[model samples]
Target: MYGPIADTIRTQRLVLEPLEVHHAEEMAPVLDDPRLHRYIGGEPLTLDELRARYAHLAAGPAPFHQEYWLNWIVRRVRDGQAVGYVQATVTPAAPEFTVASASAGATVTPGPPRLVASVAWVIGMPYQGFGFATEAARALLDRLAAHGLRDVVATVHPDNRASATVASRIGLRPTGETRDGETVWRLPRRAAPT
Candidate 1:
């Protein structure tokens, strides 16, 4: 149960708040946009589906899977309405390596578990092209860094230029490798020399 503290982050034009069960109503339509899902693995979400998604993410834990996802809702600061969602999680390095090896039909090697940060984000279609994604992402990254997290990573579809740009804008450099057919980008904890 690595739940994050419920906090509000203010960006230039947006306010990101910890995503709660009550946000599903405002999130449903945003999640339903097909354009947003173009490069994402899952299908567009309906209201019911979004509700289920929130419920699943908010649930404490289950047998096979540990609930480590921290979700947030992005809203227009002026209007105070939901526009999208952002999420991050810490994945244990050993398990990730094991899963990668198993998926590639290779033998798994025993190794000490390392924690890596992972993140994902989406904004409503109407809000796209306005830098909302970058704002939210930078805010999230700052929060994570404040908590002493290093090695933040993001996976973007090869053709998703928008997301790739967002990653670049937030200082994540390409890892020169693709996993599950998605390009990987990483940001280490050390700040670039000012």
Candidate 2:
């Protein structure tokens, strides 16, 4: 199982470390912001809810169902304070559960598992528009690419213009499809310059 990698990643302005239980205190307020949760699927979380969420997330399989759902905390390099969180996991093309029609019989489809890295970032309301999300995402993508992952993807709510822009800025182009009403963008693997 790919437990926490224990490696630290540093970018121009931020550092990414594996998420720890203590980060819940700092992250709770950021996640509690209603504006930030508008595009995210769930309602704003309370401090107690955030703690339980982390506990459950941390208790999941090390090498999660697909790959690892490695969650990391983003911190500013200048002051070393937690500002956000990011996570990555493999995509199972033929996920077990599928919707069935009321009249028609079920249909089965099989396909190879797609190795994808998905990311999410949140900077406290005060830090919005400061480029923290973009920087953190770029760093995470770079880290995954360095580990030989290909075809990274980011799914964002169509109305989330800021996140959509961040995906575009990071080189992930639209894939022309939506999952659970969320727009998806992909960045294909390309050899880095020699």
Candidate 3:
């Protein structure tokens, strides 16, 4: 399965610009607050560190791995200043998985070759409460859906109510699965249009 290529996505108030190394300098201050790391557990990166990291990410996924590392800087369309970022780590899914439906006593089988996306979002402390994260994430999911990548997932620290809210806003529900102490949330794919 072919994975997504980095591309720009636009919404009413924000632009999801494909991430480039040069964005590190601008993102440093936006991600500088230590409070932003309370749930994610990492100190803010310096400009140099961020630049190095961005360089690697900009290079795309490593060879031999059928994966995509798509990242974007969330910028206000009017002011054109980056305030946050959203990303999707996409991998080709197994042929099919059987899922048990609670309301129905039967097993359900998903379609084949569906791409699985593990998504994340981060907005600077000052940018919180502005709905930037929610908008960016919603746009990202729309883009993924357009690409025919339907299995969307996010891992959030159980205590991070803010992130949980964002996930819910983007149509994800808690899956009751825990990985690395984070709750797993998933969004079911929409039905195809006739």
lDDT of 2 by residue, 22-87 (tens): 778988876777787788867777788788878877675554355566678888899987888877
User: What are the TM-scores, per candidate, against the unseen true structure?
Assistant: 0.81, 0.80, 0.87
Give each model's whole-structure lDDT. 0.80, 0.76, 0.90
Model 3 residue runs over 4 Å out of place are 1-5, 97-111, 189-194
- Model 2 CA lDDT for position 96: 39
Ranking by TM-score: 3, 1, 2
How many residue pairs collide in each prediction?
0, 0, 0
For 1-194, candidate 1 gives per-residue lDDT tens digits of: 34443477788888888767778888887777777778886778777777787887877446565426778899998988788878888666654334335555878665555567799889888888988999999998888777756668999999999999999999998888898999999985574468
Q: Report the number of backbone clashes for model 1.
A: 0
Model 3 lDDT on a 0 to 1 scale: 0.90
RMSD of each: 7.2, 7.6, 5.1
Model 1 global lDDT (CA atoms, 0 to 1): 0.80
